[model samples]
Target: MDWPAVAAAAAAGLAPTTPIAVTLANRVIACSAAARAAGVRRGLRRREAQARCPEVHVVTADPARDARHFETVIAAVDALIPRAEVLRPGLLVLAVRGAARYFGSEQAAAERLVDAVAAAGAECQVGIADQLPTAVFAARAGRIVEPGADALFLSNLSIRQLSTEPSLAPPSRENLADLLWRMGIRKIGQFAELPRSDVASRFGADGVAAHRFACGEPGRGPSGRDPDGELDAVMNCDPPIDRVDAAAFAGRSLASTLHRSLEAAGVGCTRLAIHAITANGQELERVWRCAEPLTEDATADRVRWQLDGWLNRRNAQDRPDGPITVLRLRPVEVVSAEALQLPLWGGIGEEDRLRARRALVRVQGLLGPDAVRVPVLSGGRGPAERITFAALGDELVPQANPDQPWPGRLPEPSPTVLLDDPVELFDADGNPVRVTTRGLFSTDPFRLDAPGRSGRLSWWAGPWPVDERWWDPALKSGRTARVQVLLGPDPAQALLLCYRQRRWYLEGAYE
Candidate 1:
């Protein structure tokens, strides 16, 4: 492939003069003669490129966009060779048997595929062999071996190409080549000739694999179907979109792509990763994991939530230098889509809970994140004891056991309403009475008033006093006697009042 040329063109920000390709890492996946002649070399960083060749410009790597572009190139190649698998961002592997028959020869088919990709906006080098890995190696090395020449073709190349892992050799590829040269085994043929037992004992499995590759021994076949298959989509803009609306639009496109991919796989995802590339080449990545596996609409909602969360975090710190230009959405975990069974009477409670959760999320998004809360009961014995508003997501560790009974505590199905602060009142006889904040009566007497009656206290209900938590000062002051008032026209309209710290007040209504 014209990897060197492509690297040069990409680094220099120039149109390709000839067929060349580059990998995602910006390495020379292929290059043209003109680019190589311009002193452009493979594996040079974009910044290092300027020192080597002043006129060369650099383009940041855009894997998703590049993959999309490569799809067009692959379509063109498919016209010439029906069965082609895209092996990497810039590499292809094809079953050449059919193509060779259609084109009268394997070389002809290879040439046609190369030309087709080049015409489709890529500079490509093509290689055909009995195996995919070997073909990839030959293509990277800019060689197109004749059929049955696989052994001869690989026998002269360096062994570094045999393995995909970069750290197989401690000494590096160049050092390994140097070591082989010193051993008088400069070519793959000589390396392969080294006794297999000796190679295995000396360099371990990697060396054995390399030697086998040089000997043209086919390696293991393709892996079985990917469990977490590739499912991602991206949106690219000509001028690099920075507007929130533009990014949101791109998000919608990506969501649609994810939906299609998941539908094709017959699965749904619970987690997703979002990536945003700014115009200045900075990348922002965020992950969203849902409490429940998400529906399609919920997935989009999460995308928006994630975007807003990231933006707020970034803004709170400091705005980035540039506007984000590209947006990518990728689902990380997938499970088989199962039919959701509904109860015959319908899950109205669950539906209501979901609506409430959505409302809470919106409120939290608008206000600070801690603004929304759910009520939780505490161990103390006052209005605060009965309930506390805790921030959402906080642990709801029950302070008291549901099964074990507290001797003096109110029974299950506690009062629905609790007044934060109690109100004070005087009896019609003008006698001072005492009540605990829990509405229990103290030693001081409290007279109850009839319902709908303005002034007179009719009768008192409780001297059912409670002296609790005397050991703790905070609790001692809070826990006091409370009395139930049969106020107004009916005892059924009785109000629960409390006397605390030597004062009487209405604490709660007994509905």
Candidate 2:
């Protein structure tokens, strides 16, 4: 479900038929189906979307509002399955076996849940499958997959759908989908044919994870064996926490303590149960199931989301009469972290790597999905173009085939940083340095200058001609030449400089 668009329309008091776009950072993140018909799409800038469809209603993305409104729907689903695990604010999954047994058929259970959601004032469809990801795809098509036929069910799906549905593939992996298509793996089954180990080596850890999803394997491979002792974190509110801010503060504290405990046990939580007691003695609980192990910040997010849902639910019968007085987090399922397969090659050991990942995830949660990124090797003529930065947790798919010959790639020991704002080089007479048509410097460069960096050149190398993508006129970069320059006494103080269109610019710096 595109919850953002639905929540935005409802909050703005717009009818469901009205085209809506939920924007964040001045770009459309989600849009109503009607908006799609009108040519508005996600990732389009606000002005472009408006130009595409002038009647499209634009609204800001509000996660809290989305959670609040979705609470009623969650409650309705809970009525059918008390232990149903919430995957996100608008999505949930229940083991169909018990429900099917109770309702006498899987179809009946699906219809029952659909009607329940309808009564809650939201439309929903149910899909049953052996694996969650397959079920997500099935739900989208409103079809029930046959028993143990998840692979068959997923075989024909376009790789396009996996990235579009956040629950199936994450960290917004539209790039992964495109990479697969470019590699001639247009369908889920085609990609699934690759061996798991080979996929890991070629596309990295996240790719293997996606393979499992495509193959209809479990969400993650970590086995959730029982741990030695109780792993629970609790916090009691002195004055009932009535505000979302207060709940968030409490959640962070609890999450931090819980994370330390999990690390000590050398395990991670795949399933978490959030328990709360209201001032009126009403007990509320919800369980969250994650595709991968939960980080501290992710746990806190679940806590905050659950509390917000409870506090803001509009149902008169189900709403908490009094504020929440107690909150407890319990690990419903724990997996041995030592069994957790992290990236095969990294600088740090397993423990340090895990800690680093947690910190990055926490920062991303605090900031946004783009707050942190990791490099994925890509084919290019320059050091900066050799790799692309993908957000952490996403598949490390290359931008282009690295195996293909890159005739003019920079020599070994590439620069550590690529300057977005290139530095300029000036001649002894203060004229901008340039490489002549004869493939020689127009004038001897004297100084290199940038915002915080300034130096007189000590020594310099030849301006090697760079001609890239010459075969594709649309993709071709105009004539440029690179030079290596050292400043002052240290070999460590080296810069990668480029001359283009009669102007000198700094491309990178050697560490």
Candidate 3:
């Protein structure tokens, strides 16, 4: 039942100051205007950013909160536009051509959208273009491209914009942009001029997609695919399910069935549409747009997030009045599967992963979701922070990262034993060891007095500083200090220690 679990948790750590930097995997992804003025930039690690500007507040990323709060924005948009395709929580794509006509002009429609969202307490920009990619770039620059100038608008832009949409672009696009930069093809126009055949032969499928986007063409290209008849997975919820917990279980099973159908057909889903019917007969549907094919877990995540948002809506008009009686997942867009190169000898674990997943699901069914959990690696600056637990059948999504690195993190040989409570650390005088407000250790630790963990320290390591979330009062823990100590015979056993406000406590133990 313990499941050796880890839950996905990301919390920002730093002083509560105006110049703030939000980090994931220890690298900066966003910063406040104040931080930017002080020389902090995206991709700068906390160590370097601190050197550049010492007053900046560094925070870790929290994906759940981002998605949870974004639902209100999505609801605001849904009120105006029925099905604006959500690419991620903050970004969306909708065919504004019709809205432009209805509003009398494209500019007018955009203004209306901005006002609607602003009413919901968020700022936004709109872009008009002949193609999706062009529109995406136009939105970034807060400009409306001319009726047929999608190509021209994107031509002069830098190649770095190739990965403009993080939720949509493949990782290779970023690498491709770097490759082009090194080859002297600095502008998108230059890359767009390459021969299609050459791009296909050299850059492969992803390259072809990028070329098409830069040329003001659609990204799907000529796959000429079909989801066939079995692509839609529907479930008739007999007793009805309105609670988030029930929805989570349904999402897991439905996601697996949908993927099995896609896998059997040698295709993958690109866009997913979730439709639900409540007991009151109210019908609801939302479409999700993705840059690439949706993996089973990705599909499940979207399902869970969407349903959770709908069920938890604070607005009376937005929340469902009754339990859901019918639920269906339809793949609105599909593409042919491409052969993937494996690691040659290490690709066999996929079957094992799937088998383990099934066993966990069976356990979940027998004992309930919370009883079966699994450990997940998440972004953080501390040992316990790196690990999180998720219900077995749910998607294991890690928060805060396109990559994982923690600067100020302790070196490896992680603790094999985690302590539930902090143990007291003592000096030779029987007085508790302490840390000063200036982050200085009061004195060297001498005796350990933690019941069975008691011992005399032979050697010790730091009083390393850890400060997180001072800005948010509900989540802030003032600056804390940590140290490593060898205890018992030869100080044979090792222990991790934490100090806060005149108290010392055991954190963990090493083998």
Clashes of each: 38, 0, 10
Worst 10 residues of 3 by lDDT: 1-10
Stretches > 4 Å off in candidate 2: 170-176, 195-201, 218-229, 339-511
For each candidate in turn, the TM-score is: 0.40, 0.65, 0.72
Per-residue alpha-carbon lDDT of candidate 2 for residues 17-123, written as tens digits (9 for 90 to 100): 99999876567888999999999888887879999999998887766678778888888888876667777767777777778899999999999999999998888
Per-residue alpha-carbon lDDT of candidate 3 for residues 1-511, written as tens digits (9 for 90 to 100): 0000000111232232367776666677677656788998887877899999997666665444455556777778778865677777666778776678888998998898899888875567777787777777787777999887888898999998897567658877899989989999999999999999999999998888889888887653212233344689999998899888788778777888898898888888888888889999998777787887888878888888788878876566768879999989989888787733236675578779877876776677667889898888877766677777877755564554425555667677778887746678778888877887777777767987886878789889988887776676775345678888987575499888877555766778898
Give the top-scoring candidate (TM-score). 3
Full candidate order by TM-score, most accurate first: 3, 2, 1
- CA lDDT of every candidate: 0.56, 0.79, 0.75
Could you tell me the lDDT of residue 474 within candidate 1?
A: 68
> What global local distance difference test value does model 3 have?
0.75
Model 1 Cα lDDT, one tens digit per residue, 1-511: 4433443454455666533333233344333565467666666544345555566544434333333344455556656654344343355565677678888987788788778877765667776677555676777666767767778887777544443322122223445555566677757777877889998897665566566767777753222222243777677766676554444444644665687677777777655666778788987654444323456555655455445434433123333457777778777655566632236776458658656766665575457446887877554444446555655533343343233334455434444576635455654455555554555443444344324333434555564455776777766454556565565454345566666677655666667
Candidate 3: residue 205 Cα off by (Å)? 2.5
Task: Please list the residue runs of candidate 1 whose C-alpha ends up more than 4 Å from where it truly belongs after superposition.
Answer: 1-13, 18-33, 43-48, 140-144, 160-184, 220-511
Q: Whose TM-score is higher: candidate 1's or candidate 3's?
A: 3
Q: Is candidate 1 or candidate 2 better by TM-score?
A: 2
